[model samples]
Target chain A: MDEIPPVLLRILRFLLERRMLFQLLEPYEWWLRRKYPNPPLPQFSYQVTIHTIRNLYGRRGKIAWASLFFPSEFFHAARLIPFYPEIAIGLVAALRFVQTPLAAAEKAWFSQDLCSYHRGGIGMSLLRLFPRPDFLFATSSICHGTVGFFEVLREIWNVPLFLVDVPKQWTRDAEGYVAEQLTAIARHLEREWRVHFVWDKPFFFSNRTREILLEVEALRQRKDRMLLPPTKNLDYLPYYYEFLGEETSLRFAERLKEELSKPSKTLPHRLIWLHLKPFYSGELPALLEKLGLGVVYEEFTTPFPEELSPSSPLKSLARKILWASEILATSRGRIPGILEALKRYDAEGVIQFTQWGCRQSQGMVMLLREKLLEAGYPVLFLDGDHLDRRHSAPEQLRTRLEAFLEMLEGRGSS
Target chain B: MCTLGYFCRYVPQELLEACGFKAVFFKPDFSSPQCSSLPVPFCALCKTFISWALNHREFSGFVVPLACDASRRTYEILRALSVPAFSLDVPALAGETAVERLTENLDDLARELLAQSGRSFLEFTASLKQALEETLRQQEAFFREWGKRRRAPDRIPLLFSGSHFAHVLLPLLEEKGFLVFPDLPENRILLGEEPLSLTASPLEDLARFTLHRLPCPRLSGPARRTALKRLCGTLGLRGVVIVFSKFCDFQLYEIGLLGRSLGLPVLCLEHDTTPSFPQWETRLDAFREMILHG
Candidate 1:
């Protein structure tokens, strides 16, 4: 199982050739690494995590595909190594093998109107790159497409699918509702897989995981914030870690926080990123760095200051999940925290990535952009797909980024 | 005089009617203006929901169920705009707890509506029962008449699924000797009697009816499957034509499940908010040929 399918390896080679196009920045990267000797390589950690999970898929064990918003502690409890479509597609795209699988998904009647990550994930399964999952689970009200994604997964795998319906308002009733579902999921896993979810292992990891995120958040709050974006290729950071309940994901996060303890001096324009950055979709980040607009904060990677209450572990996890981010029920759900970040980071402008095929984040961008503009911050909805390189036509993105930079320039740096 | 709007069928229509608030179905139009940047700005229904909710001065309030991701965000956008709104957290999966939660949400909305409009729900239900019973009779008559119609023996039967009908294509399908059981949810539940007459308390009756009805893909797996099985069996369906809107996670995800569990031909049709919607011409024709020839 350790040996990869030759066809997949060949496809990877096809993608890797084009990915070499990014190597032109090596000398500059080398210089930065030389400047900051102990910085975490976000891309390196990203690859490590993806490879780790992908390897788990190859081994003989129960595999579950979950929505990004699902609690990882449950998967750990069930002894299922988890993966998700968006991140999986991203890993495939980053490896340069997204097109064939994406084409496969499209051919299998997957709509182009869905998120590209979904298309890529579905395509992966269609092309026999990603094997059918053993079980499927998802959380409602976060990503609009995840339910649809998992529904397709259920059909493919013919597995029992569980959906955790997260409420819009995080009330005590909502907590109880979700907790009941989690209990049901545990029972289902035990009956089907014939294994009990050992409580203490996940309990230990969940608490430690929260601690690391808090440390990262505190470091991010330092007076002199790093001018550079996450040095590590931080694709699916929270998701990858939380899904496996892996302490390594936390270790890397701590490394990132430790690396960014000091500011990268001053930059002309400070921009706050709205969601997950498309790390593999060409050289947008490096290009943005060159344009002198530092991403002072990112909504996805930065942890919120949450008080952990572990008296009821699952309930506490549910509380953390709600507090970590806003459920899809409201427009202004995540706005308050993001607005606080924008102010704290002294962001001159904001840019939300409208990842192709993903309606969840993109659906909220209009209100997000409008709110930022009203709050006196220039904002842009950067249209691109995370895994599909075609979304970031270098010239078009350059023009949009430049236009946004000009708008930011209009507001002279204090 | 407050005109309240709702999108999903799960939101109690009888209750809204009973509360004396004029209810509007937030229908999507092809040309509804979209926020060019927001992905699925209008969701499965389309940009019309957003444009209609944001721009229209007619509605005093909009109540949207948490059926899917897009509508949920729509609720949020409406709230942000300070438009009077209620986002009922429709449980994505069905169970006793989920049903209880939904009932509570419905109760909360009822309270809000009654408080705002100063009308008693009980009074409305009492006055509306005779009319509800009459509507059921009309529905029964329509179904009976439909069943009595003589049709060619070779006609292909399709169980229509998804959130809404591809209203424009029904005639075409009929022309092709296709009989459709329109179970894609708005008012199809009207055939069931539990909501209007099962209990003296209209709210309790509505909650029970909503929780226990033939499920849409929005509810729990077993319930949704059960609903599909019941419809396909009762209709004696030969195939399923699911007309799901673009960017609808709930409907989009259920395509494979619909195909799998029923062991029948399922032609999934996608609808965008485009003027020239991508009609599944080839697929439909192929589907027809398969069914007819078989």
Candidate 2:
């Protein structure tokens, strides 16, 4: 649980304004290492996570609302601390730490063909890495993994678990259902946590929502005259998942909004990321930006605020889920809304990120690229894993992005 | 000369019925353990269709669209068992090219079916079309009747569990005096059909829908419990019939959860295109008895 990298430690020390405390703790780290030679570490990463979370919240008196993306905003809005186990489990799977435990769980359950993420998450939960969440909320927005994963947690932990139901596609009725479920969950939380869950929390939820939406809208803005600094790709996930509900998240979003409002730095060719995690190498976005090519929008980032409607809270949630659903629905189908956004954002090319062994994504890549081509958008289908660099075709992706950017520039010049 | 029974989906049921063979469309019970053994990952309706077809000998054949991977696999498994299966490959799109390809596939299939069953394609096609047209008309009429039945005194109104099942099964169930309250299909279809303003990637959509739609027993705990509570509250439904296709893993995973949550008598059924009228009749009778007595 205490495997903090020195650099990250320094960063955290800086961020938390604990520089003097960090120096005081530095000598204790050496003394502790000598006192306990080879401290017994938890075999599973989730166990380590559980220990870390228990340490954090126990001291601070914060309750975690473990959730997926669909219920994330609502949970955040309700003022509950949100934890995304998928991001953690995904990182573990990519790192290949919990394979044996995952395999054992899969074999034990006789679910050999279940998604690796499900098996891994279950393995982590079984190992008690998640520490029993105060409340577990899952969205039926995507896949059976979270549903069963949370059920196992409920049975094991005997805690309150809620399923935020989202419809298969986005529609008004689905929005109504989602809104009702969110409201129900809100009531349940209020009863259990002894805290009022208000939707009209001025600067807390609604302000954050407005900020997220504005950030998204800014990301959608074109840099035809090179007015804005290109948004970093690596910052997207951490900004959303890690910083969500934190005051820093709102501040960072504000920083981005401010940066976008500034005059041109360098006009970069704009591109859109289709799927897969873009921040894996940490070099792609920087490289693209260096090469005067900016990633104007990412599929995951845009769906959050773009789906929200100020008039209807539940409808907004449902729309967000539906918007999220279309991104993963099928390969060949055209998301007119997303396409229109790409055009509006002045994205010259689209990068379809394909993770290996992700059957759902792999199955639809060819079809999706074909559709994008038909729509006259220069598309680059890049096959790689965000964590598993061994499977990454970085050189190929770079080549494709570069070539596509060149072609766009050529078209513009002609 | 040989009669056949087909369940849901619009394929060979009409043709088989028109060929002077008795065609009975039966929906299966989806809660039973016997129904869960089939190989599909989601949707118990397919399994019920298959289990009935395999158990009963009266029905001579089955026809289905290979619209999905599981159904296609089910068709193969059933075909190998000498079920005299006919599979029509329907494209994802409903364009002219898809229609042409489908017509050709169906024509070839219709010929082979005609020869094996001692029926001509011309006669079978005309009759089958008529039966299908009749079924469509009957389906429409049933909806109207269901609307009237909703207002009746003895109407056992049951809320269909989810959008996936409610889309196809709700109307059929409603026609039989069960009114589906809190419509799930109308909700799903309404959302699904609306144009997106900002959509996620296509893969993301698939993942989301698969997560939501695929009836995994393990994942649907919350949904099953919600459905059970709703059923208990709205209609005080005497019994719940969980319908799914054979080889659907998601729904099979859910049976225990649903059963435990509801405590109401649950009848689970699995089906493929194979006919199983006798077995289904027996099960339906048993279910009816349980509802009346238990």
**Candidate 2 chain A weakest ten by summed lDDT:** A40-49
Q: For model 1, what is the C-alpha lDDT against the true structure?
A: 0.65
lDDT per residue for candidate 2 within A1-414, as digits (tens), equals: 223344654564354443234344445545655665534322222233443343333423344545456545565566555666656665554444545445545444414344444555555565554434677777645443445556755755667777664444355645665676666667776787775644444225434745665654764474533322344533345346544544545655655555456555655567776664633345665666767766667665553544344455555666666556555542212356557767788677777665443334443444455557888887776666554444557678778767877888887798
The best candidate in terms of DockQ:
1
| Per-residue C-alpha lDDT of model 1 across residues B1-294, encoded as one tens digit per residue | 678887677776666766678888865544556644455434646345656677766787888876666676677677776778876767666556665777688778877778877877677667446445554576567656656532445677777765643665677678767886666442334333333355465555556557666677665265577667766776577898887777666665566556557778888777675533334666778889887787
Instruction: Please tell me how candidate 2 rates in CAPRI terms.
Output: incorrect
Chain B fold agreement for model 1, TM-score: 0.84
| TM-score of every candidate | 0.84, 0.50
Query: For candidate 1, lDDT tens digit of each residue in A43-147?
Result: 545445545544354443577777777767767766777766666676667677777776666666665566777777777665555645777878764664666
RMSD (Cα, Å) of candidate 1? 6.4
| TM-score of candidate 1 on Cα atoms, chains taken together | 0.84
